[model samples]
Target: MPDSFGRYPNMNISEYLDFFARAYGLRGASRREAVERVPDFTELGDLVNKPIDTLSKGMSQRLCPGRTLIHDPDVLILDEPAAGLDPRARVELRELIRLLASKLQKPGPDQLTHSHRAG
Candidate 1:
C-alpha cells in the first residue's frame, strides 16, 4: 500500500495515476483498466487534471486508496482511513469502503474492525 507521499507534488492527477499504472507494468488494456478503476472508487473526476499539491485534504486522502487499488490487490488494509476527513468526506469515504468490501471476496474473521468513540 502507498503512503501519503504516493502523490507527486508537481504532477496532475491523471499523470500521477498513469505513472503508477505504468510502474506496475500495466499496459494496453491493463493500463487503461488500472487508470479507469481509480475514478470509479474516488470522487476526483473533476480534479483529474489538477496538480496534486493543490488538492484539499479530503481530495488528497482519496489518492492513497486509489493508488493502493491500482494493481487490483486481493486484500486491502486501511488504517485510520477517515482520521482527518470532514463529516461529508467521512461519509463518502465510508460508503466507498463499503462498496469495495462488497466487490472484493469475503474476508476472514478479524480481517476487519471498526472502533468509534464519542467525544
Candidate 2:
C-alpha cells in the first residue's frame, strides 16, 4: 500500500488527498476538510499545488502516512511510517503518533467520573 502513493504521479496534493478521502467514503464538508488538512498534516502545505511526482523522498514519506490516516482508523498498523524521512520528519512523525495515542487513550468525562466513583 505504501507504493500506492505514486499510482497517480501527476495528481497534485489536493487531488491526491481528495481521491483517498472519497475512497474512504468521505463527502461534502468532511471530504473537503480532509483534503485541506492532509497537506498540513504531511507538512506539504507549501507544495500542495505541486504534482506528486515532484515530491522528494521525505515529502513522499510523510504524504503516504497522511493518506493512511485520513480515515482515522481505530487501530493503525504501520510497518515503518518514517522509514525514509529525515531527522526532522521522524521527529514530527513521533510527535504525531504520541498525540494520536494520547487522544485515543483519554477517557470521556462520563467515563472519568465513573472510574473515580468505582475507585
Residue 16, model 1: lDDT of 88
Instruction: Give stretches of model 1 more than 4 Å off.
Output: 1-3, 101-119
In the range 8-115, model 2's lDDT, one tens digit per residue, is 777988899899999999899978877887777566888888998888776777677678777666555555556656667667765665443344323311211111
Clashing pairs in 2: none
In model 2, the Cα lDDT at residue 18 comes to: 93
Tens-digit lDDT string for candidate 1 (1-119): 32245547889988888888898777998788667668666778778889998988888877766775676666666666777677887777667766654543345212342435221
User: Whole-model Cα lDDT per candidate?
Assistant: 0.69, 0.66
Q: Output the worst ten-in-a-row residue range by lDDT, candidate 1.
A: 108-117
- Which candidate has the top score in lDDT? 1
